[model samples]
Target: MTTSTAAPPPPPAARAATPPEPPSAGRRRQRKGSMRRREAITGLLFVSPWILGFLVFTLGAMVYSLVISFSRYQLATDTARPAGLANYEALITDPKIAIALGNTLYYAVLAVPLEIALALGLALLLNSVRRGAGFFRTVFYLPKMTPTVATASVFLLLLNGSTGAINRGLAAIGIDGPDWLLDPAWVKPSIVLMTVWGVAGTMVIFLAALQNVPKELHEAASIDGAGAWRRFWHVTLPLISPAVLFNVLVLTIAAFQIFDQAFLLFHRTTGTGSSDASLFYAIYLFEQAFRQFNFGFAAAMAWLLFVIILVISIIQMRVGNRFVYYEGGDR
Candidate 1:
C-alpha cells in the first residue's frame, strides 16, 4: 500500500492556465470612445450655423460700419472717400449735436428713475393683491403688447394741444393744462409720460423677480419685527437689484436711441422735421444720412453713439458687481 501511494505522489505536471479575459470590456472602451467622438462632432455641427451667420452677416456689418465711419460715404452712389476725422470734428462743434445730446441726457435723467420707481411700485401693488391677480397682471401688460405705432398715435391724440383728453380733463377740474406736446419745455415731459406707458414689461420682470425672492427671508424679517418698508429695503430690494440693473441698462440704451417715439411724436408736435429741437442722436443720424445726404456725418455720429453706449454699458457692468445682489453668486 505504501509503495502504491509513493507512485501516485508523482503528481500531474500540467496546470490549468488562466482563461483569457473576455474581450467585452476592451470592446466597450472602444465603443465608448467612438460614442464620445461622435457626440463631439455632432455638437460642432449644431453650432456651425451660428458661427457662419455671425461671420458672414453680423460681424461683416459691424466691420463695414467701422470702415465707413472714417470715410465720406455716399448712400446714393456706392462711392466713399477717406475724410479722416472731419466728420467727428463736425459732430463735436455742431450745435444740433450738442442739443440732441443734452436733450437725450435730460430725457434719460427724467424717465429712467421714474419708470423704475413706478414699475416697482406697480409690481409691489400687484404682488400684494390676493384676488384678481391675473386680471391685474393682464391689464398692466396690455399696453406693452400694443404696437409702438399705435401707442404713439394714441398718446398723440390724448396729449394734443386743444382737443386732447388731458387738457379737457384739466378744464373739467377747473385747471387749465399747458399745451403738453407742443411746448419745447413740456416736450421732454410728454415723452416721459409716453415712456412710462410702456413700462408694463419692465414691471412684469420686477414682479417675477420679487416673487422668486425667498418667503422665509421675508418671514425672518417679519419675525424680527421689521415693517414692510424695512423688509423691502433689507431683503426685497437686494434680491431684485440685478433685475433693476438690467432694466436700467436696457432703458438707458433705448432712451439714447429715442427714435420711434421721437420720430412720430416730434413730427406731430413741431411739424418741423426734428429742426434741432427734438433731434435725438438717432433722429439726427437719420436726418443726416437719409434726409440731408450727409452719410459721412451720419456714420460719424453712429460711431460716436456706439462708443458712448459701449462706454456707459461697460461702466454700468463694472459698477453693477458692487450693488447687484445675484443669488448663489460669489458674494
Candidate 2:
C-alpha cells in the first residue's frame, strides 16, 4: 500500500519522430516537364493562325511566282512552258526596264527624305501641344484615312495645269506654276506631294517615340544651356533615332513599290509622251502582266523587285543599326 501501484512501466525507449518524406526527384522533374509542355502547346496554339496564313498565302504565292518566272504562259493553251533564263535575260536587255528602274529610284530618293522630314516636323509640333492635341492629331490623320482612289481624284483637280487652285495661287503670287501632271519635269514632284499627304501614319509613330523619351533628360539638357534647336538636335534626335530608322526603312520600301498614285495619274494618258515621266517600275510590271499578257516577263520583274527590295532593306538595316541609339546603348 505504501509503495502504491507499481509506477507505470517507463515509457518505451524514445524514438525520434521522422520528418515527412519529400516528393521524389523523379516525380518533381516529371511535373515540371509536363508544365513546360503545356505552356509550349498553348503558345503554339496562339500563333497557329498566323503560321497557317503565312504558309498558305504569302509563302505559297511567293513559291508559285518563282516557279512561273522561269516559264512562258501561253494564253492560247492556258499553260506554262519552260523557257529557262530567257525571261531573266529580258530584264537586262529591255530599255524600258532601265527607265522604270531609274524613275523608281528617283522617286524613292525624293519621297523618303520628304516623308521623313515632314513627318518629323509634324510630330514635333504635335509633341509641343498641351491643348486640343487630340483634335489636332485627328485632323492631321484624316488624310491617311482617305482612300487612294479618292485622293487621286481630288489631286487631279488640284494638279490641273490650267484651272487648278495651285496654279491660281501661284498666279496670285505672280509666279507661274508648272503643269504639274503633264510636264515631265514636275510630274514626279507632283506624285511626291500626293505621297506626303498620307504621312500621318509615320508622324504618329514618331509621336509615340517622342512621348517615350524621358522628360528628365530634356530638363537636364535645358539646364545645360542647350537651346531648343540644340536640345532637339543633340538630345531628342539621338533618343528617337531608332524610330527614324524604322520610318526610313519602311518609307523606302513603300516608295519603291509606289503604284496607285502613279497609275491613277498616268494610266489613261500612257500613250502620251508626258506619261512617260510617271512610268514607275510597279506600273510597268502591271502593264507587262495584264495589258501585254506577258506573265513570264512580269514574274521576272517581280523577282527583280523582290531582290532589289531585299538588298536595300539589308543595307538600310546594317547602316541604320550603326546610327540608331537605344536607351540601353544597344541597337
The sequence of per-residue lDDT tens digits that candidate 2 reaches over residues 1-331 is 3766767888799899998767896789999999999999999999999999999999998898898899997555679999999999999999999999999999999999999999999999999999999999999999999999999989998989899999999999899999998789998999999999999999999999999988998899899999999999998999999999999989999999999999887785545436568899999999999888888889899999999999999999999999889878776
Alpha-carbon RMSD of each model: 8.2, 9.5
Q: Which stretches of candidate 1 lie above 4 Å from their native place?
A: 1-53, 268-274, 329-331
- Candidate 2 yields a Cα-based lDDT of 0.92
lDDT of 1: 0.86
The per-prediction tally of clashing pairs is 0, 0
Alpha carbon lDDT at 97, candidate 2: 96
The deviation in Å at residue 150 for candidate 2 is: 0.6
- Cα error of candidate 1 at position 270, Å: 7.2
What TM-score against the true fold does each predicted structure earn? Answer: 0.86, 0.90
Highest-scoring model, lDDT:
2
Alpha carbon lDDT of residue 104, candidate 2? 97
